[model samples]
Target chain A: EPEVTQTPSHQVTQMGQEVILRCVPISNHLYFYWYRQILGQKVEFLVSFYNNEISEKSEIFDDQFSVERPDGSNFTLKIRSTKLEDSAMYFCASRPDSNQPQHFGDGTRLSIL
Target chain B: AQTVTQSQPEMSVQEAETVTLSCTYDTSENNYYLFWYKQPPSRQMILVIRQEAYKQQNATENRFSVNFQKAAKSFSLKISDSQLGDTAMYFCAFMRLMNYGGSQGNLIFGKGTKLSVKP
Candidate 1:
């Protein structure tokens, strides 16, 4: 019942500015992941992290995107220069082990103006 | 690469009725996992049910059950005695099993089917 929580449920930023989406995964979870869902589109994987390093990333996770576990509990995704196309609902997920299913946060709706 | 497909874009069922959402995937790996996630108006992804490829028996959780055909690469979710709360967008996802030292599991999701339970 421990859920992943995300802050700033709604974020609006200028096109060229930087933005950071924060997530607090389940306390005991080991793997963390980021996913994007454009309006009316399928959810797409952005990146996955484990053991304090990135395990894999999709093409959408380019030079402008980076993720870090700044502390033990917080996982943050920073976009250096936001583009209009970057506007989407970003979801953070975590799981306790290999065979366990990933639990998702409520999601942060990022809107670029 | 693995891909999950949900052919039905939208569906509706009367309250207390039953409905099934279809899903199919294209994958070469023998060992993997399939799942159904429900995203209500809140846009929160909630796990509905999971089916392991190695398991021959289908997974059932109360009113929610899965009809998994491993050979056909088909996995579908059946909701019995549906209610208004069941009105949500259902997504079918696929994930390859993780190796001890390999990459972490990442879900490949379908476009999703919006189910509306009308009272």
Candidate 2:
């Protein structure tokens, strides 16, 4: 199975600091997504991007959240001024196309101290 | 709004035995997809199996298969001849088919069921 690769398997940052989580999706995939799973909680969708723009986003993707497919290969999720509650495992996923299954990355464990 | 429910929070099965994880969803869309993903201690969400609503035949991958009841809105995963490595948190998810922006694959997941394959 093709895998989505995420950078910095784990990250520790202080509250109020910004954090950037990077992902390298499968080359042939056309759509990308970002999701978060707080410890002991279900995974929640944050946003989905395609064609260099956000196609859809959940309420969790507020003003502090942003995503970019910088340089056409790297997809990044940036959280500005993180909070303690921001601590969670952020997962990146990409799909070949519509109606196809989306594959996930190993995830980046973000710990906001 | 669509929601997935995994009634069983935790289930235990002996190695070499079979265990089934329950998942029910609420959706009105006719065309959609249901999936089962396994997350081990590593936190990697691995796709186990998926079923398309249009297909009446169940989807199977080796020992992992789903009992998809579209009319009942139930999609349950049955792990046959389970192994120790099968111990993990299993999540059920739902996605609506996109008429446009198909690439924006948004998934709504269930709370998840923790499966323990005891050796």
Candidate 3:
């Protein structure tokens, strides 16, 4: 079965540095999303992207966060300034459309120091 | 706002036995979807099963089945003949049904229940 794939399975960055997490969603999928989970917390929604634009975002997806579908297959999440609290497992998910079940990637573990 | 709650933090079952994980959600929308995802030690989220709110028939996948109580806003997953491989963190999620006018479906996930199956 085709699955969502993310790059840099694990990422480590300085507190003030910028980092971009990349994902290649299933080729036919039309909707993409980003979610994060703190070490021992529930997975939290970050943002959703469709038609190359942001559809919705949460409070955690503030000024520092941005998502881009720079190409037909790549969906990327950029954090302008990484904070210690930003360290978490970031997941990329996609679905055929709004009514379909969203499929998740293995996740990228982001570590900030 | 929609929220998913999984009150059980941890549960254990003897190998080859059965287990059930509970989930509840707060959503006024009549149309939505509920799901159970399994995350193994690899930490990869895998969809176990899904249930559509409009469908009264419960969903079942092999040994994995669900008791979906639409009126009570509860969705529980039952794993029959549980095996050692079943040890993982299970998450319950909720998402609103997609509308025709370009609405995105975002999942609201519960905290997760850690299931350990012993031999």
Candidate 1 residue-wise lDDT, A8-83, digit = tens? 8999999999999999999999999999999999999999999999999999999999999998999999998899
- Candidate 1 lDDT, B1-119, residue by residue in tens: 89899999999999999999999999998888999999999999999999989899999999999999999999999999999999999999999985562337899999999999999
Candidate 1 clash pair list:
none
lDDT of 3 by residue, A1-113 (tens): 99999999999999999999999999999999999999988999999988888989999899999999987989999999899999999999999966678889999999999
Off by over 4 Å in 2: B100-103
| Segments of candidate 3 deviating more than 4 angstroms | B98-103
Best by DockQ: 2
Clash statistics: count for each candidate: 0, 0, 0
lDDT of 2 by residue, B18-117 (tens): 9999999998788888999999988999989999888999999999999999999999999999999999999999998865635356999999999999
- Between 2 and 3, whose DockQ is larger? 2
Ranking by lDDT: 1, 2, 3
Q: What share of the true interface contacts does candidate 1 keep?
A: 0.82
| Residue-level lDDT for A19 in candidate 2 | 100
> Over the full model, what C-alpha lDDT does candidate 1 score relative to the true structure?
0.96
Best by lDDT: 1
Over A1-113, each residue of candidate 2 has an lDDT whose tens digit, in order, gives 56799998999999999999999999999999999999999999999998899999999999999999989999999999999999999999998888788989999999999
